[model samples]
Target chain A: MSRPRLTFLESSLPYAVNAARLIVMDRGMFVADFFLATTVPFLMQFLIWSYLYQGSSISRSFGVLSLSQTLFYYAFSIAFGRLNNGYDVVSNLSLNVREGTLEPHLLRPVPYPLQKLADFMGGGVVYSVPIILVLAVFVFIPPVALNSFFWPGWVLLVVVSQILCFTLSWTVAMMSLWLVRTDFALSLLTTSAAFFGGELLPPYLWPEWLRPLMSYNPFRFMISAPAQAIVTMDGGFVMTALAWTSFYAIAFGCLSAFLWRQGMKRYRGAGG
Target chain B: MKKYLLFFRLGLAVELAYPVDFIGYVFTTLFVHLTRFLFLNGVFDLTSTLEGWTRRDVMVAFIFSVLLSSVVDSFTPSIRTFVRYAHTGRLEPYLVQPLDARWVMIARWIRPGSLFIFAIIAPIAMLTLSNLNVHPTLLQAVGGLFALVIGAIVNIAVMATWSLTTLVSKRDLPTEFIFRQVMRLNQLPPSLFGYKALTALVIFLPIVLTSTVPAMVVARGEYFLLAPMLGAAVLVMILFMISFRMTMRVFDGSGG
Candidate 1:
């Protein structure tokens, strides 16, 4: 919820309120359709997966813990969905390079990445409230678990995982300076989540060969680790997932910064 | 027909303008199909006849989805999107001329994108069924082809109804996703008897006839002789045609 330290008139309160009013008047159907199609199907798929997991052999541990995992998925999936307020750094950079907007942001006090990050986080916070409320209900409803579920290690790991995802995406967006588009590049990062981030289907259902590598994959940190913290109530693997997650975060974050600096040198544009 | 061809060419031209889009679209769709095939692959690997069906027989069932998509492209290109034009007041322009609306609408879909999909669907299904095509009696292939066409017509009608609903309701709830589910139920080659009422409903509710019965006719599966099979298909088509015309009347008359 941290605001970028700039006093932009557009982000000012009066303008913001006006924007919200205009949005409600114009694009309400977009919200209704998104809820019905995307969110409903997401929760439905979660229900079916939880049912199947309980039916399988791991039902003993999974049955007791799976509800929280489902809730975790619902929360994080919504979090991820809300966090991406259609401002993929890569797409934005590609468009900026095309339209010559990057120079203005660069001239500003805030770093471009920081500016984008804050904007996305602010928007994500706005979206997260309703989504978090709906998802949290899964925790308290019938057969809910309320107790001291201490898994600080896992929570920290999820933070690291989100950082790593941000770095990788930012890096790709910066790469747009060098290339016209990064369709394959963006797909490579995002589709892994589709499979492993436990969104489309949980990582547990992956073929036997692919199960163990979930720890190495940066995705599980975003999706599986936080849920694992509550459901399993075991922080044993949380440290490991976090260690790798943070490692990738630092590694990719630096790489992206380096690439951005270097890519800027290659930037030839209609001078602003 | 010529008028429809022009509209279709417009769609085709739009597609051609974006060369890179095809690669991503085709790859993602093909990957989804592959994953679905893999899930079934695991099931078949574990069990036989899927409660009394052969592996190749199951493959035949899966092929129906690709075939249905291909056959229905002429009906609703890109799955109910043509109906989008109809309701958007765009179709008014098409209606203004002495155009065969159906031909112009369907023609918009004749392009490279679906051809890629056709390529993906045919190879795997054909490989599995080709192992078992045993020179069926001429009546049988004809019946299979006939049923397949009927299934496509029904899909178009149902999807047209879906598209028209947007005009009245003013919503877009992943109409293509609905088509995907329909494809899911129909494309899978497994039979669903003895499961429950819902599964039974899949058979005659016209989803299964799109793929299952046609595959059966191709494989000469046991249901080919049954009167209920063909009768159900013909009845579904009649209803679909009626529904389609009614929707057209509502939209065309309503000026929507």
Candidate 2:
């Protein structure tokens, strides 16, 4: 057997270190995030659901799952919340735009959006690991087993859906060109996602009148669909989830591309 | 006090200058609150109570959380400003001034957007109280006001600690992000947390001191909590003083 050469991609190294440094350098922040992002949200959800399920037998099976499955579903839902932090590209790009660093980068040979996306993915990989580890704890503590037949597809859907989520977030960030202050938009997006995206609770549990509309929303696909698919392991559900995610990914990608072009066209640098 | 009022007036003017942005922000905040209320309502729909909190209790908690956060947010500087000052060594200018550096920072950053929120939420909170006929007694009102004062102090002290972190770190420390996350606890009832978590929120983070205690005082006439809540707030202020002092010791102006 031939030994393969170990090669590190030099271009990608900085963002990896950047990501690692983000978590490692700030011990206080890491600890805070571990609790606030992972531990507390899960605890909050678990407690709420526990109280919610108490003495209520009407929804005996929580969205096509038994009691044990329902516990895992909610656990996984909380896990999905942590996983969503990987998309920091939006905030980073908006900051860069505001600080005027983006002006210099406009003339670079590589597309600014693509480069930012790559840098973001680099950080995403590093930032997301601990969250996944936290998720693993929740997955095991309750010992919710996945559906073997559908687990593989569900995993695929999650990966793809995450990319779609990133794209949608990035598109929102590009709007900072006009908005200048993206804080309100970002806050709205996050708040909307938490509520409508099924992060706080499943859309299945939201008001019935709103369910049909929420089911079509991209934010729901961002968390609920993948989370449910992994647990439910329904083939048809998995396929639909993939289809909706792809639709969003493509839609958001085009929107981002268009926005980037428009922002570039409008760019007047400090010296310009 | 005159300086603060002058700065606050200046802050108000700056806020009102951007009419469109300000209106947009207020609307967005209202939308966010509406969604949260809906989510809370949805949760209650599943169960009559959450962690022993009735819908009214939770709604009141949510309102008070918004009020307290708005009170803090109205004065607190954005994390970006902290990063900018730290990076550019602008702290020197503030430091050299006759006034306190922290006060200077606060003077410049009184968020009008947040002030608007206070205007909106305060009325809603009172209306909700009256609608539920909470009709806080004279003692309850006084106790709740006392809680608010101490809670605001604790809030400022805690934010000051976060702001002072810029003295040591070159980059923004996610102080604001972590703060927003921690403040979410304010919207939740104390019963949602167990003993350990409750203790952490009460003594360490003091999120419960911000909204829950005050809301309870008014809503349930729980004036007995005044002493303990005030004590916790004082402890937090002292802790913040120590943290700020220590942070100053390691501070190298813009050298980080």
Candidate 3:
């Protein structure tokens, strides 16, 4: 059809890229912009932590760790935000089905999943600029302690966690097919992961009782496990987390793929 | 209101269509809430009371802030209302509309999916409040709901006040971006802020009234009845009036 036809499958991918780029370049979400607004509060936080804890880094571990963790967070979050393989794509594609546009995607030249990923990464590092800046400020400062764990372990954890998060999220996104609603599924992941995965705050900060539960949860492996390994230099359970992460990523990825194929077989052309 | 209903229905369809996004949004909200919890946890460990509230009280206040604010911000018009519309030059269309544009703008946000934000945490907040053993009478419930209404008013006013800067600023984007960060203040416990900051928040900004007062009413026991609660609503209304005047001037390109 000579392509770029404004067809459902073709149109959404470009739109996604444009949208991501728009959000990033969006003057409101700028790097300098975030820094300007955040400086006072961050400084306030920094001052509060630095003064109270003074030489005792242990007191404000999250704040102290952020000195290094923040940088990694900024870099990883920005790059990884694009690499997110699920979330919006799942939501959008799911919408395409409900809206009766799924059939067009099935007709496309590109593999739909790959197309979604391409669209996501199109804007590249733009959306992450703010995070990047936040990280950069922390770059000059040393991480609280990095002597204990090897960099490779930290790297492996980061890579694995990202994989795990992406894999699980991708699987979770497929729920849109059979279900009338997917919000519950999404909420469940986000809430658990936010704490357990270490996105909202570090898992270490969670109460001791909560920590054990979080340690076993895949959520921690995705964000905090690697992050803590890098910043705290603790690798005691890094391998364990990585193993679980790998298991979930592969398991969930296969499950999602199977479900999608099966669902596609039952797919009636829209308005069903 | 009818216009709002129509827009709300439209929004519902759009939201329902992308149910998967509900999860992503939930995740982001979860992340933000966790961030606050950790902050409070650390601060509490460091020192007992930031101002007058205990560590438990502060935690309750934070959860209240996030839960209620999530409802107000998401369901109400403009998810990040001020910046999204103000920057897109989208606010202009609203001004020309015949109905109460501000009301329309505020009420335009209807994310039924956002309902999950409240549902997931409501039990938790209540459970925590129960654990704290602070009980409010039926009158307190009315008063707390009243505080939420005030919170809605204050949120709208704050958005509008930021809208005033949206009018004249050389860089509208920067203004919105700045306001976005300013929006973060709502997520925090007001008592942690100093008097000037707290007063500014309670009076000029009105952020304190959103979460703190209601939480106080519920968790603060008998004092909820007597503390200067009406002042926050009155203050926000006044700010709205002032910002509305500025908006008019800005609309004419005089101030903006």
Chain A: TM-score in each model: 0.71, 0.81, 0.65
Cα lDDT tens digits for candidate 1, B72-116: 643445434455555445556655667555554445455545665
* Real interface contacts reproduced by model 2, as a fraction: 0.42
DockQ of 3: 0.23
Compute DockQ for each candidate against the true complex.
0.14, 0.49, 0.23
Candidate 1 per-residue lDDT over residues A1-272, each given as its tens digit? 99767465443444335434543443444464355434554544453344444434333443244554655665556455433323255656776775666787787665777666554443433444444564467556645544443445654554465566677678767756765444444544444554455554445545678667644566666555555554555656666666777877788789988998898888876522
Write candidate 2's Cα lDDT for A1-272 as tens digits.
99675344454456456766766676676666666765555566666666656675346545656655666665566656555543366666667766767766666544566656556555555556654674576568767566576767776777777777778888888767775656666676677677777777676777889888677788888777877776665779998888998899899989888887888787654320
What fraction of the reference interface contacts is present in each model, in order?
0.03, 0.42, 0.20
Candidate that would win on lDDT: 2
Clashes of 2: 0
Candidate 3: which stretches are off by over 4 Å? A1-24, A30-87, A122-124, A127-139, A143-160, A180-186, A234-244, A269-272, B1-52, B59-63, B66-74, B77-103, B108-145, B156-187, B199-205, B216-256
> How does model 1 score on DockQ?
0.14
Order of the predicted models by lDDT, top scorer first: 2, 3, 1
- List the TM-score for candidate 3's chain B: 0.78
lDDT values of the candidates?
A: 0.55, 0.69, 0.58
Runs in model 2 deviating more than 4 A are: A1-28, A55-71, A138-152, A270-272, B78-80, B87-89, B194-200
Please tell me which model should have the higher DockQ, number 1 or number 2. 2
